[model samples]
Target chain A: MILLAPWELLLLMFANFFSRATCMTVGPRSSMGFETCYCLSWRVAVEANNAQAWRTVPAQCVLYVENYMLGGQYNKDLDVVIEQISTYLNGIVAAGDGKDAWVLDIDDTCLSNLLYYQGKRFGGDPWDPSAFKSWAQRGLCPPIPAVLRLYSRLVQGGFKVFLLTGRDEEALGVSTAENLHAWGFVGYERLILRGPAYRGQSAVGFKSSMRKQLVEEGYRIRGNVGDQWSDLQGDFIGDRIFKIPNPMYFVP
Target chain B: MILLAPWELLLLMFANFFSRATCMTVGPRSSMGFETCYCLSWRVAVEANNAQAWRTVPAQCVLYVENYMLGGQYNKDLDVVIEQISTYLNGIVAAGDGKDAWVLDIDDTCLSNLLYYQGKRFGGDPWDPSAFKSWAQRGLCPPIPAVLRLYSRLVQGGFKVFLLTGRDEEALGVSTAENLHAWGFVGYERLILRGPAYRGQSAVGFKSSMRKQLVEEGYRIRGNVGDQWSDLQGDFIGDRIFKIPNPMYFVP
Candidate 1:
């Protein structure tokens, strides 16, 4: 009876159109498969934020801009996004065990490399090694919006927060911490950066090794969020690992 | 003729007694087992900045404290430690397959939380909700000694460095990054922290889940480092896990 209700039928029609509309929009810009993947991801991310259907699309779509396409143009509607991500994080934290819980990541995922991108003064191509090295040494980068809000909500909700990054270990003591304070981020219990590992592994290899170490230490990672696939690459089967958009670019 | 002559015997006896006397003084404290386990940790930590021995200790301790200790107190002795840990790390990075490596905890083991301690500013006990909240908000801390040097060495040496900590997700963006910068610590490829588990697991449980995540991603941790034993609780076997002193205090 409920399924046949006029209101229910109307709502179902709206959702179908909404999904199709999103697929149509993304399908042309990228490869067909990638487009399909993006559409599915967009839907998941949107639903992940808005508990309902696409009620929060406009809000979330702008967060991507706030993150990747910043400078000159700023969208005021982003407030909706900020609010939604915060709400999503709150739900995760609330879902946590009564004991401490947290999510972690580092690099462009949490600390924006906007400075790295912009520091080049928007010149010399996107991947400037020297500029990036200088940028990292300076330790100044804005917080990624969704990440900032998610972290804040988790902290505010009484869960412990951790920022695990791939920044060089020698530079972490100062650069990483100051960046966190400068950005007004709150509620992290510890900052885990790369240290030494067995000889010959790459940074990505080191990352997974570290995650495993955390398991040995006895802390559960409820929700893992990051821009790089490496950040989420772990055996943490039971937890929800949320990947935020890192459109500024990809890491190797 | 093969036996020692009278003069040679006398020389041997004199050398043995002299060695025994030296053993009575610094030898007991300098024994590999004791030094590695206890006494040398405290004494070496203090003298690390000035003593030549600082170079010989593992590099994990050096890079973890570069900004606060390596660059500050033992600035002059920094080079030796850098050289040593780099040599050690390079070997590991070169030799490691996906199956074996090490993970280091960033807080007291790699970086310093002295400010949190000396300021008497945790604001409240760890057990107190309000205090924990406040502490998470402040997010200002320094680096530990020896750690920075260790990190530098590991990075250069090719050891895969993964920083493991129990900090919550909320602090991922700002505090962690800033703190690392302040200390000038570097070379970590990943930072894993504690956060909420959707399946209702504790932070520790989530950490264990992460171990499988890391393995699937390709990389096995061969060793671990941290001030907290909890940082080393994951499932990878045969990896060495080293604990350093947390002079500021201990967590439950």
Candidate 2:
């Protein structure tokens, strides 16, 4: 049971409204505010440019990024969370089996383009999809500073690193890796991407399912770091969780 | 090309010796003085451990309690890595096209008892499997410190944490969860354990095959962390590799 920051709660509210209005479909758990809002925010967040602007945008239409977008800082709490993670990980390796490991997520947890949809005079309110695809192609957006350091250190420590993103399978190859490299992140032997829909429908359960599969293969996940509540729901082998503030936005 | 720390290099030397003498396995290329001492060290390290004089040894084993095992360390570098992950994940979610995910591992990476054998004075030179099993059942080990903090932070951040352990299927129930909880590690919705050996032979390509299965199941792993090199050799969807130190030792 984790508490959400005020801005995160507000963003969720906006996401709920936008989901209802846009008629977007997301994985199961459609029962209420979180799921729907989660979906809508992804669509909207990509169009935002900063946290403040995201706060200003309405839940309806979102503007498109006209050019390559990059750079922005998240809430200050981000540092505290990262520090806590570093400490936890150090303990695990020092005390537990000195194996290599760290669990990670791609969406809101790793990237920050969701702030792009904020306050821009868009086609409507909230955000739009067409504009975001173009922005992603540029791969210029900046990453969260604290988290970046964590990943880099893991690599430096000789621990095997893995990147588990829920992005489309199509985004594999140069697009995803290049984007990560551009942001000064490295050392991923594998870049797992989302596959096609399962059982004729999209579902958030996919992440969990995949996580289970990895366990069967013999990886001992030491730490799991992500932004969304769903990101932390799987069976990770770590002791604690590090959650940074995503007050400026939300995602499905 | 990760640079091994001085201690790590020394551990590799010992690992190479043990692996060659006991398993007759090919040593990792990265081990120092691979050609000359590879085979000799294997026999020597094992004999050294078995020698009566070396009853009390400090072995490189993972801190595995019941379920959760600690990863290791909180340093400045890991912070930057997670920050980059946050950036990519933010974009993926903003697109409303991706999902959230993290990859994990078991065995030395998660729950480990290898150190118990090395550190404790078991009789004889070469290690005995029975002694290792006895140590696991005893459950006297602690969790890795830094890894625990990472797990806590990730859980707090809202990501779905999945555990990927290589423990045989028989090691389930209270023992599993209890170990994790006791060590201060979190549990998962799904736990994947090793099925029976194939045709009485252990399977090849450890974690990679499982990661492939997860991809087929539609998971986009943004972070994949594990202690063994095999954990990072998979084809999953991890954008970064967060590795922790495992000088306590390695298994072939």
Which candidate number maximizes lDDT? 1
User: Which ranges of candidate 1 are over 4 A from the true structure?
Assistant: A1-68, A71-99, A119-126, A198-200, B1-252
Candidate 2 lDDT by residue in tens digits, A5-98: 5665555445444332222233333333333233223322222111122332233322211111111112223444565566555655532343
CA shift of B58, model 1, Å: 56
* Tens-place lDDT digits, model 2, residues B183-216: 7677443555566652232222545566677677
Off by over 4 Å in 2: A1-73, A94-99, A119-124, A171-173, A197-203, B1-252
User: What are the per-candidate TM-scores when only chain A is compared?
Assistant: 0.61, 0.61
Residue B83 Cα positional deviation in candidate 1, in Å, after optimal superposition: 47
Per-residue lDDT for A147 in model 1?
Answer: 63
